[model samples]
Target chain A: MAESSRADNRVLLLKLGVIACVMFAFAWALIPLYRVICEVTGINQLVKADAPAPAVAASDLAVTAAPVRLRFDATVQAGLPWQVRPLVGQMAAPRGEFVRVDYEITNASNREVTGQAVPRYLPAAAGNYVKKLECFCFRQQVFKPGETRRFPVVFVIDRAMPADIGEITLAYSVFDVPGQGAS
Target chain B: MAISTTAGHAPHEHGKPTGLWRWLAATNHKDIGSMYLWFSFTMFLSGGVMALCIRAELFQPGLQFFQPELFNQLTTLHGLVMVFGAIMPAFTGLANWLLPLMIGAPDMAFARMNNWSFWLLPPAALLLLISFFVPGGAAAAGWTLYAPLATQMGMGMDLTIFAIHILGVSSIMGSINIIVTILNLRAPGMTMMKMPMFAWASLITAYLIIAVMPVLAGVVTMVLTDRHFGTHFFNAAGGGDPVMYQHIFWFFGHPEVYIMALPAFGIVSHIIPTFSRKPLFGYTSMVYATSSIAVLSFMVWAHHMFTTGMPATAQLFFMYATMLIAVPTGVKVFNWIGTMWQGAMSFETPMLFAVGFVCLFTVGGLSGVTLSVAAVDIQLQDTYYVVAHFHYVLVAGALFSLFAAIYYWFPKMTGKMYSEPLGKFHFWWSMIWFNVTFFPMHFLGLAGMPRRIPDYALQFTDFNRIASIGAFCFGLGQLIFLYNMLRSIRHGQAAPHKPWEGAETLEWQIPTPAPYHSFVEAPHVEAGDNGVIHSMTGGAHH
Candidate 1:
């Protein structure tokens, strides 16, 4: 019985040894298989994500041949507590070139109260080019019993825009401009 | 092993379960075991029907047949049915049948809890199924039930949450029973090490369910409060961060993954050596690895949320923790193949599935590492890649292990052998069609197709069509398996003692039609060279 038991132990040990070797091979094989799978599955697809380009920007063609000629789509509201960002929607540019924003603001308040409306461009980077558009930050508006106001400014750009870049963005804020008492 | 009954319970013979009352009032382990199995099989088919509905819907795009609301409902129901209905119940069923037999015990320590545990599921599933007809339709928020979205859903979501709570309670009760039984009910000769791999696995998995099922319960509870009771636990407007919800969910969720997988680990451990006709290799190492994987499971919860924009330090910690799981998991795979190496081998259907499990589970594991990388996961987090990875783990790993287990033990249960040729055909069909259905999903996901979308860009139309076809074939093939199991049980040729030609387990060595009671005289213990009972023999089983 002892001899038979000793032989069984030997067999068990040998089996264990062989088993270890097989495991090593399986693990090794998995490394490359994993690599191939990762590559196939686009494991690196979102590493450096690029934001999508906009569909079509009218500002894209605000070229060096013209001033920053921007057309604003305006809606006038009577007694609705708001007015358009650009009334005449007049934007000055060097004919066909890209520069900065130019626009007119109208306050439709009945009382001698002061407030300001912020402007935003369709493409984001248009705000990056400055000095052409007069901002609400410049001065306080006081409508002395129905004030019809027009604000304007002038500036240009360094003329550096990507050819495929067909969009520019401008964003602004609207608030009761400082030093003008509306409350 | 070396445990006293933490709770007071008598070892009672308990009368034989007879008539309908027996089933209703049944606390005996055997009756409960049979009930769990039958219930799971019923659920398996029911879930299978939902899968077919999903396949039929996706058979053609452009809303050919089913409307989008119905399509979303089908998908939601499919997820709930498969997760709660089919897979979890299947594992619990195996636990019921095998726990007593493997442990050399008369029955589970708390048999009443086992019965109560199973009874909860039918009612809960009924509620979930019944939600379909109740006014606003089923929960289409998907299984994760991401908040604000889930909060805003209709009555179906409410029913689904209630159903989830019931399922959670059942799982916890069932787990507590297994833990108590494994600890207290082993025969006198058995030690902890003498326990089968399955017992150790179920022990760990039981602990997982007990710990995390409560967390899932807590999570859904919070969801309910957020939705109806004006709680701001997940509302960002009320000083609550939405991302915190993901943290809690995955905390429960990651361990829930292990709760499913560790049993598969145990099943694979059991089947690998049987077919190889060899003693299990690295038995102690296997134990340690299982424990390690369980421990690692808690820390890796955040790996799922890598794309949710956590701090760099937090992301790094989670990423590394997740990767370390691969080491222990790797050890398990090594141990399995190691058990089979240079041994005499035969290709029974059980063995075939076991071998397939090794290869395919590795495919699942290797993909797991890709998701573990903080940088790489940014792209893959909620895509079809995540979907495919889990199915590979759950389906190929757990479900295939389930198949191998069914094939392995059908004889012991039925007293007859299933046709081997037919079994092999089912295996190959499942294997081929499973790959076809899940593999293309990776490419589609990589090609930027997001998951949970009802419609997709025209570019993805072809792969979806092919996948739909694969899904149908796969669902249809399961019929072959069900038919084979039933036919074999009723009228197939008789199975002898130890039907697997070279299987060495005590379960196989027992008589065909394994009697209502087994080894009732005295325990027969087998000792290895190290004077350890490799597995305890259940002599006092009756």
Candidate 2:
């Protein structure tokens, strides 16, 4: 009986050891799985590289579309010596139609600079519907000393967007990437 | 295995080893348990000091005492020390001292491993405390250690991670030792369901520790690699989502909440029945309820991240699952009240803390239900309401139960009776001050004061002052406990083998000042046996 109890303890120890390992792997598995879940469901507004939102068939347009006012805003983060502003402060677009906006950027410092633009949407609830097809935010933009460039963002306001949100403001803040500086 | 003749004796049975060296090299569960308790008390004092500092700063709201950065460190360390250092270890200490006695086992299954597990804690604790004096101060990103902030932190964050890693290793080792001991070493006839509730609680908690401690280790290792090895596990530019980090974290983090509470539930299960002079009401249902709570804990992690903007369906699912937890928890609460129904109830210090635990913890549970609603949480997230809610659960639930267990077991442990008046005084003082300190924070949260901020607007002044004063009184009240315990060990009345008349556990059946090698004979118990040694000795030993 003593020997049997010792063996029983050995088995339980091994069992606990295996459970610990499997749970560790389970925690790791949730990482990639969460990204997939977020993208497929559009929960957390996990932006996809090509298009963030599900494709809304062109046929689903509103029969009599109301015009929505779109506004653009841009600014440079504290340490990045760059000047960036929206080319046009506001524009009008009908629901279910695509809109294009530009932001002007200039390197205000003596050295060349590389900056990444991070996008933000007001009412933050509107983030998932403001799908970007092409935006400067998807890639880093580089500027030479005394250089100026115009960056464009192409987006479509889903007809499915809540009617309460008649006005949408898209803002971008530019920051210098440390290791990618001047490249 | 026949019951041995040596089962019910005092320390006079053998020559006792003496000196600090005996403690330094000891493998006895009783010695190690004493060490764990003392160490946890020291940590409790340290963490309590930090809490007072926080209340002092927030007294009038404009960072009266500390710089904002220092307040951040104080808040972070307070949470870390109290949760990890004080509460978790205190229960582990209880398990060590009582499990072998309660289950009629000779000692833990792996004695040397128990020693190693406990020895690992001091160094880890030193690493955490030492980080404060390091160049940039200890981790200021809060105890959650969310990435991006963690990656950007200075050297102190690295120390905190290392400390956490070491602490995780210690807990996992302790957990394995516990699992092996309980599953393999219960005395004959003490079947799985027949084991005491404290043992059952430890069994479940140990399994939980093994399952989640590694997840913590994994996440912290990633954060370390992300900081030093350029790994992009949480870096957005490098194609990693920080939200994924929160997902993995809360998976482990949510269970950790139960890891601290379940053992307290087990402790209270024992206390309520004893003081009320009745068998625990609905024992089978209580076990099932604890198991169900453990299972549901895994599904409710996302309720914490509701404001992170999960899909409405996912939010709804988590909200419902979180509310489902209230059923099992409500069952346990009712079981406690039922245990006291129509019985000769006594208001001993331990019983007072036990009853207080039920009342305050139920309040916390109700607030938990309120916060579980995705809409309500959207407003309450990261607010003082969240702060108030957890302290109700943790301080009132876990800490109160811990005090109950201490008062219940004090005579058995030290072989002397504590001053009953002092114990009651300590209980009332703590209860009043505890409520005063935390209750108004709910209003403060509803009025829009965010947590983890050192400075607040002028509107939050009056209640903050009241809370600060209550906190100081609460801190002072604990000194009464410390003095009472110290005096009891040296000068109090001698305790009998069974101090409380209604107590019927295996621990009470043994002699007072439970010897080093408890239950070396493995006393044989039977089904429906109240106490084998109690009946055998005919209650004359005491």
Candidate 3:
């Protein structure tokens, strides 16, 4: 009887061990699983897709509508040795109308460096409504020693945006990407 | 072979080792259980000290003693130590002591592994306590250890991660032993359904630990690799999303909450029925409710991350799912009340703590439901309200239940009855001061005082001062508990074989102080011998 119970113990241990392994593997699996869930749910849509935006019809633009205030903000993370400033600090653009804003970037470091810019919306809910048509944040930028450049961001605020949100701040933080050149 | 032969002998036939070596190399379930309990109490005191320090600094909100850096460390280590070191090990110690005796097994299935599992805890706790002196003063990213902030922390973070890994391994091993022992070693005719609620609760809790501890290990391992091994799993600068780390961490974290809770529920189930002189109401439904809670715990992880700006549809899904947990939980609460309904209920120290658990855990549960709404959570997130919500659940709910278990089983384990007056005083002292400390925080949170801040505005000063005073009182009350337990073990009156007349279980059927080998031969369990069901038949047979 003791021998039989020992065998039963062995079987139970093996099964529990397998379950633990499966759970460990499941944690790793959640990475891909999270992406799929986010895609399906339309949450975490910070980055734009690779496909180019469809051309907007001239008639779709609402030029005469009341304008919403737009504030531009830019920052450079530490270790990047770069400065970024929005040429236009703030502006008023009518909803459903395309607007372009310029930003100046200077690499103060002596060596060539690659950097990527990530954008954040102030009233986070506004991220889905602000569609990017043309933005430098889509790809990494490489700069030679002490180089400077100008970039423009073109976007249209969807008319479906809530009326109470009359102002939106678009901010970007540029971080140095080590061991990579511009793509 | 010789050691095995000797260990198998009946208690009085052989000489057990004496002095420090006995504990250092102890293999008996009762010895290890005592060690686990002592270790957890020590950790509980340490964590409690850190909590008092935090309260002291927050008394008037001007950085009185600890700097913001050190305050953050106190908060982080306080959480880590209390959860992993104090509560979890306390439950494991209880399991080690009670499972074999309750189920009529001679020993745990793997005795040596039990010893190793317990010993691993001290080193892990030591690593955490020693971290305060390290550079950057421990991982200050809160207990959740959110990344980017965590990535930039100093050597203390690495030590914290290593400690977490060791704790994870220890938990997983302890869980495996529990599952194996309960599944394979129950006395004859003590079928699964016939088994006690505490055993069932431990079984489910063991499954939860095995399933989630590995996920925690995996997520923290990723954090470790990101710190030194150049992985971009959580670093947003390298094409990775930081929010994903939140997803993975809460995936393990939500179930971890139940891992601490389910055992408390089990412990309460035993005490309520025993003191009320009744069968546990709806034994089958109670089992189903526990299982439902465990399964639902996984679906509700996202409720913690609602402020991370999930889409409205996703928010609604999580919100509704989190609220659904209240249904099974309500079933449990109702069952506990139903057991006490119209019965000869007595308010012993254990019963008082059990009744206290039901009342306050509901308060905590109701607050949890209030925070489940994504719309409401967005406003209340990271506020003192959230702090009040969990402490209501954890300190009042989990810690209260532990006190009940210790008092209820004190006689059985020590062969001496603790002072009833002293135990009752400890309960009331803790209960009142506990509310004084945490209840005001709800108002503080609603008024917009953010948590984890070393300093707050002048308007928040009154409540913070009240909370600080309450915290010191609550800390002092535990001293009475410590004294009660020690004095009873050394000098209290000898207890009868069954001290509580209402108690019915295999453990009580045995001699007092419980023999070194509880059952040299497995006790046969007849169908009507089931305590829960037998009580339902109304006690006439006795």
Q: Better model by TM-score, 1 or 3?
A: 3
Report per-candidate DockQ.
0.03, 0.28, 0.35
Worst 10 residues of 3 chain A by lDDT: A56-65
Instruction: Report, for every candidate in turn, its global Cα lDDT versus the true structure.
Output: 0.71, 0.84, 0.86
Clashing pairs in 2: none
Off by over 4 Å in 1: A1-183, B1-15, B519-524, B527-542
Ranking by lDDT: 3, 2, 1
Worst 10 residues of 1 chain B by lDDT: B1-10
Best by DockQ: 3
Model 3 C-alpha RMSD vs. true structure (Å) is: 5.2
Candidate 2 docking DockQ: 0.28
TM-score of 2: 0.84
Candidate 3: lDDT of B386? 96
Tens digits of per-residue lDDT for model 3, A41-124: 667675555454455555444432568899999877645789999998999998888999999999898988888899999887
TM-score of chain A in every predicted structure? 0.42, 0.65, 0.65
Best candidate according to lDDT = 3
Docking class of 1: incorrect
lDDT (Cα) of model 2:
0.84
